[model samples]
Target chain A: MLQEHAKLITFFSECKELVGRKRLQKMIYILKKCQFPFSERYQFHFYGPYSEELTLRVQELINLGFLQEEKEKKSGYYQYRYTLTGEGEKFLDHYNLDMPNMDEHIEKMSETSSRFLELVSTMLFFEGMPKEEVEEKVLTVKKKQNYTSEELQQAWNFIGDMGIQH
Target chain B: MSYQSEQLREEKVFKDPVHRYVHVRDRVIWDLIGTPEFQRLRRIKQLGTSFYTFHGAEHSRFNHSLGVYEIVRRILENFKEHPDWNEDERLLCLTAGLLHDLGHGPYSHSFEKVFNLDHEDYTREIILGDTSVNRILKRVDPKFPQNVADVIGKTYSNKLVVSIISSQIDADRMDYLQRDAYFTGVSYGHFDMERILRVMRPMDEQVVIKATGMHAVEDYIMSRYQMYWQVYFHPVTRSSEVILTKILHRAKHLYEQNYKFKLAPLHFESFFKEAPTLEDYLKLDESIVMYYFQIWKDEDDEILSDLCNRFVNRHLFKYIEFNPNHQFEQWMELHKLFTEAGINPDYYLEVDSSSDLPYDFYRPGEDEERLPIHLVMKNDELRELSRESDIVEAISGKKRTDHKLYFPSDFIEALSDDSHIKKRILEILEG
Candidate 1:
C-alpha cells in the first residue's frame, strides 16, 4: 500500500512539474513570437482570470529552475525566455504532453476530489459498514496501506475527528 | 455537479478591510453568509465592550467571520496544490471558518460571565444541529455538516486541516490579529502575514514553519504578544467590561429581588430564566443591548441607572497599576474605604489582571502537550523553532502579568471637601 501511494505521489509531483513547465514553455512561445522583449504589438493580452492563472504558473516556473528572466534596461519590464534544461526536456518527453494551455485541469481536480469523497461515502453507507471497516475500506480504495506509522496514525486521527461514522 | 463550479448567480463580495474582499464563488458560502443568522453577526461587536477603549474597534464578528473564511480559502488553495494535501478537506475548512464564531451572543464576555455559556460548544450545536449553516453544509453531503462541526470542535483527525482553523496560529488567529489590528489601528499587531503563509508547511500531524521562516514566526508571536498587551488587555477596555459585568449582575439581582422595573426586562427574560435558544441569541446584539441601555438610563433603580449611564455615556472608572502580591492589604483597605464613602466595593472596585506567556520551547515533563512550533530544515529534519532561532528563544517561556485596580474617581472627587478618605484614596492612586 505504501509503495502504491508513493507511486501516486511521484505521479502527482511529475504531473505538477509537467503542467508548470508546459505553461512556462507556452509563455516562452508567445514571447518568442512577439520578439526577444515582449511588445504590445504581439497581440498578447492578459485580461481575465485564466490569464491571471497563467501568469501565476509562469511565475512559478521562473521560481523553479526551468525558465530564465531578464529585465529590459530601458523599458524596466520583465522579459521571460525558456531555458529548457536537460531535465526539463526529459520531463516533457516522459509525459509526451504538449506545452501548457489555460484549460480546466484545476477545475477537473476539484471535481475529482469531490466525486472521490462522495463515492466513498456512498459505498460505505450502501455496505452498512462499521466505522473501522469504512475507514479501512476507504484507505484500501485509495491504496494508502503503505503509509508510515505516523502517517497512518495521523490519517486515523483525522478520520476519527472528521466524524465519518457509517 | 461539484459545489465549486456552482458559482453564485451574481458574484457576492464581502467588503472586508482585513482580507480586502471575501469573494464568494460558491453558492453555498454565499447563501450561508446571507442567512439572517449569519447577518446577525453584523450587529454583534467582535471585541464586545473593548470598543469603549479602542474607539476604532467597532468592527463586528461578521467582519471577522469573512476574514477567517478568506484566510481558509488561501490556505486550501495552497493545500490543493500540494501532493500530501487531501482535497476532500476543502469544504470542511471553509465551513468551520465561517461558522466558528456563530454561537457568540451580545456582550459575549459579560454574557458568558453571568450565564456560564461556552461559545465553542454553541458553535458545534449551530453547525450540527438545526440551523441555516447546518442545512447548507448538509446539502453538500449528509455528513458534511458533521464534518464541519467536527473541525470546529477540534475532534477532526486530519491534523493539517484542523490546525489550519483551530491551532495556536491558525486561520482564526491570523484573521483576528490582522483584522483587529486593522480596525483598532494599532501598529503592535502588524506582522508579515505573507511571509508567514509562504513559510507554512503541512506535516502529517500539523502545520509547521520552515526553518528559514523562523523569524517570520517569531514576528507573528511578537505581534500576538503586543496585541494582547496593547489591545486585548487595555485597562480602559477592562474597565468597561467590569462596568458591563456589574450592570448585568445588578439587573439579575434586581430581577431576583422582585424589584419592579419601570420597563419590563422582556428581552432579558430567557437570560434571567437561564435557558436561551438560538432565536434568543440571534436577537441579542450590541445594537439591542445599547437600545436597552438607553432605556435603562431612565430606570428608578439608582445602581442600574448609574451603571447604564456610565457604560453608554463613556463615564468609565479610572484605574491605577496594582501589584496583587504586595498591594493586597492596600486593595482591601480601599474596599472598606469605598464602602464607607457609600460606594459599593463589589461594583466599583475591581482587580483585573491580564497575562501572557508567549511561545515556549517544548519541555516534555515540565509542560504537557506544549506543541512547540516546529521548523522544517533544508535537510527535511524538524527542529523546535526556539532551539535554532534567537528571536523566538529570547521571549520563549517568559510569562508577563499585569494587574490594575479600577474604581470610580468621580465619586472620590465628589466626596466631602474636608474628607481625609479622599486624600487616602488619592495617595494610594498616586503610589
Candidate 2:
C-alpha cells in the first residue's frame, strides 16, 4: 500500500522544500526518469509530465498533517504553495527509516535535475522523438510550452551540466 | 490550460515483429525505453538456449518487452468501457508491462540457475536503484518507480493492476506466447488474444472474461499447453541447457580447486564464489558469456575445453525421452557404462526434467499471488474459468513432465568395439 505522502515526504526531505504543484510534479517526473522507485506514473499531460496520483497524494498528506498548503488569490484565480510542515518533517524522519538510499537518490537527481524542469520535461513530453529528431521536436514543442529556443537550451544545457550519469 | 491534455507532438512506434507497431504516447515511456539499461535488453536473448532449437529465438528481451507493453496497451483500451477501471492506474499498468523483464541477463534461465539469481529481484533493483529507468519513473511521480516494480513484483495492493501483467491470463503470457511463436515460426502459441482482451472486464480483485469469450480462453489454454511442449520444451534446447549448466558447474569446481586457466574467468569469479553482486550480475549478457565460452574452448582443462567447444559449435549432446519408472535400469547401466568407459558421468550424463515450467497453466493455490481466471456468467455471478471450460480444466493443475537423458553420442560411438557396449547403448537409444 502507498503511504499518503509515500516517497514524496522522502522526496521533500531531500529537497528541503518544493514550492508549487507544477514544480513538484515536474521535479518528481524528472526523478522518475532517473528511475527512482516512485509509485506515481506520469503522462505527457498539461504542464509537461503530470501525475494525478501526485495531486491525490498531496491532498492525502495535507489531511494526514504531513504537508502544509497556502492559498492566495492572484489575478482572479487561486494560486497555491506547499511546504513541509514540522509534523511533515517528523513524519519523514520516522517513515523514512527504511530508505537509507534516499540521500544518494536525491543527490543523483539534483545532478540530473534542471532549473528549466519545464523545458526538459517538455522535451520529454513529446511521444517518441529519437536522438536525431529531438532538435526538430523541441522546435515545435516550444510553441505549445511558450518557451523560446534559448530557454530550451538552458533546460537542455542544465541537463548537460549535471553530467547525465546518475 | 486544463491539467490533463499533455499530448505528445506525435505518436511514436517501434517496429515489432509480433505486435507490428509498439505504440508510445507517454514521453516518460519513450525516455525509459531509451535508457541504457532498457537498451541492454537488446543484447539479452529472450528464450536463451532455445535459439539452438529455434534459430529465430535469437530475438532479445527488448523485442518481448515492447510486445508486452503493446499487449497491455490494447488491454487497457478494452478496459476503458468498464466502470471499475481506474484510469490513474493506466500508466502504472503500461510501465509495469514494459519493464517487467528488465532484470534478465544473457541466457537468463541458465545463468540464474547456475548463479542462484532471480531476474525479478534485479527488476526491482534497476527500477529502484539509481539508474536511468529509475530517474524516468521518478518523473512520473516520486514513488512511481517502486509501484511499477511492485506491480511487476506482484506486491502492489492493486490486484487488478497486478493481474494485468502477472496473473494466469496476463499480458506477459499473451505477448510472449504469440511473440515466441512468431519468432520460432510455430503455430501452436497463436490464439485470439484480441477477442479475449475485448471480453475482459476489471472485477473487484481480478480481471474477468465474459462467458462469451470462454471459447477463446479455452483456445489460449490449449495453445499454452502446445507451446510448452512443442516449442518451449523442445529436447534440443534442453540439451543445450544441460551443457550450459555443466559448464558453469565445472568452472566453479575448477575455481574451487584453484585451477588456473589460459583465459581467466573474470566475468565468472563472482559467480564461482557463489555470491555475485548486483554490479557483477548486471555486467553479464549473451555476448560476454559467449566470449568466455569461446575462451574456455582453448583451456588446458580437457573436459572444460571439450564442453565449451560443443556449446560454442552447436555440437549439442543428443537426448532420448527417459521414463524413469521403466528405464531406471537402463539409466543406471548408462552411468555405469560411461564410468567404465573412462567418461566422467558427472559431466557427460544428465537427466533433464522440466516440470512446472514457466507460464504453466496453473490452478489457484498453486501460485502465491495469482488468482485463477474467472468468467462473468450470464447471471452475473463469477465462475472460475477451468470449472466451466473443459479445455482449460483438462490441462489445469496437470504437471506434464518431460524427462530426457542427455549424453555425448559421438563419444559413446567412438568406444572400443570389443566391449560391444556401444552397440547395446545404440540399440536402446535408437529404440
Candidate 3:
C-alpha cells in the first residue's frame, strides 16, 4: 500500500468507526493542524477545510475493499459512516506503521458534533491570525451559521484543551 | 480616496471573440490590466499543446483571463439585487477573476510536473510580493491583496464570494469551457451559460442554481464532460504533452550532468535549480520556452537535441492503448527490447493516464469530489443536483480513466525489418 493511504488506514484502525462527511474532513484537518505526518493538502470550502486528495484516497481504499462506507439519510440530507473493513485490519496487521498515540484525540473528536468541528477547523485554518481577527473572520464568513460569542469562546477553549494552540 | 471605488471616465472594452466584449468600468481593473505582469499572460498559451491538435487553439491566458473577468462581471450584475449578496466584494471578485491565471508558466501543467512548481503558489507570491500588481491592489486597501489572494486560493472567509469565482459552475469554468471550445472549434463546450448565470443565487454559504435552471446546469456539466474527453484530454494533445514533458526532463537531466549547451538555458536556469524567483518565473513564457526548444535542437546531448527537435517540429510521439497492470510482462519485455534496440525507454517511452469524474454528488470519501452543485428547489428547499436530474444521476460518481503507452513509432519504424530485435518489439507493440 502507498504510504499516504496507509497513514489514513492506520487512522481508521485507531478510530474504529467515524461518521459524517463533514466531520471526517474537519477531523483530518484539525489533526493535520495539530502536526501529524498526514500529508493531504486542504483548501477551505464552505464546510471549513476539505481535502480532495483525502477524499480520493478513501475512495481508493473503499474500491479495494479495505474500507467500508455506509450512507445514512438524515433530515433530507445524506450522512456517511466509515470503518476499516476486515481486509483493512488484515492489511494493517502486516505493516508496522510508526504512528503517534492519537486514539484519545481521535475518539474525542469523533464524539463532537460536525457543526462544532467545522467551527474548530475553520478557526484552525485562520490559526496564524490574531484571536480577534480570526473571530471577526469567522463571524463574517459564517454569518449563516450564526455562531455566537459564547460558541467562539468555547472553540478557543477547546483548541487550548486539545493543545492545538497554546 | 480608496482606489477600490475609483470609476473610469468611460467603460473600456476589449473585443473578445468568446465573451463578445470584455467591459471594464473600474479604473483599478483597467490599470491592473496594463501592468507588465498581467501583460505577460499574452505570451503564455491557454491550451498549451492543444493548438497542435486544434489549429485555432492559439489563444493566450490573456484571452481567457478577460473572458473570466467578463463572466464574473455579468454574474455580479445579476447578483446585485440579491439580499445575500454583499456589494463590497465586487472589486475583489473582478480582481480575483482577472488575476486568477496570472501565475501560469509556459505549458503550465507539463512544466509544473517537471519542475514540481505550482502556478497557484506563484499567483499568491505575485499578488503578495513586491510587484506592480501588488502595489496596485494595495492602493485599494492594505488588506485588499491578501483578500484577493485568499479568494483565489479558496480560503477567503466569505464562501459566497469564493463560490462565485471557483464553485463547480463558477465563472472560471464557464469562461474556460466556452473560450477553449470557441478557440478549439469544438462543439462540446457549448451550454446555456446565460441561463446558468441568471439562475445563480448567492446563498448564505455558496451559490445555488434555481431548480428551473437544472437543464442548463445539466448542459454545463455535460459540456465539461465532453470538453475534458474531446478537447482537454485529447490523445494527440497528450502525445504532444508527453514529448514536451520528456524534453523538459531530458534537458533538466542533462543540466544536472553539467552537459554544456550551445545556447545557455538562461530562462530555465531558476526552474532547473527548482528555486525560481518571481522575476525568474515571469521571464519565462511559451515564447521563451519555444525559443529554447528551437535552439536546443542542436545541443551536444543526444537525448536533449532529439527531444527538443521533436517538440519544436511537432514530431510528437504516437501512442497505443496500454494497461500496465494487465500487460506488465509484455511491458517489461518491450522495455528490454527497446534498450537492446538502442532506444532509451526512459526518454523514448511513457505511459500517460487521464481520468475524470464527469459529475459526482457530495459522496464522502469519493474520487474528485467537488462540492456538488446544489439546486434551489421549489418551497425553499436545497437539493443536490444528481438527486434532481436523471442525466446527472446516470453519470454521477463514475470515474473514467484512459491509459496509453506513448512512444516514437518513427524510431521503431526506422529499424531494419530483418533485425530480430525490431521484429519482436514490433510484435509486442502491435499486440
iRMSD in angstroms, per model: 24.6, 21.9, 6.0
DockQ of each: 0.01, 0.01, 0.17
Q: Largest lDDT belongs to which candidate? A: 3
Model 2: residue A74 alpha-carbon error in angstroms = 69
Better of 1 and 3 by TM-score: 3
Native-interface RMSD of candidate 1: 24.6
Cα error, candidate 1, residue B175 (Å): 1.3
* Lowest lDDT 10-residue stretch of candidate 3 chain B: B355-364
- Model 3, residue B167: distance off in Å is 0.3
By summed lDDT, which 10 consecutive residues of candidate 1 chain B come out lowest? B359-368
TM-score to true structure, per model: 0.70, 0.70, 0.82
Q: Per-residue lDDT for B158-209 in model 2, tens only? A: 7678888877788999988898999899878899988998898998767899
Q: What is the Å distance of residue B73 in model 2 from its true position?
A: 1.2
**lDDT by residue for model 1 (A1-166), tens:** 0111122222333334332222332332322222222111111111100122233333333343333433222252223223444443443344343333322332332232222323332233223446556455444333423334454454334334433342
Q: Write the per-residue lDDT of candidate 3 for residues A54-114, one digit (tens) a residue.
A: 7666766676578899878777566778999988777666556788878878877876787
Q: Per-residue lDDT of B83-180 in model 3, one digit per residue for the tens?
A: 99999999999999999999999998788878978788899999999999999999999999999999998878778888888877788889989999
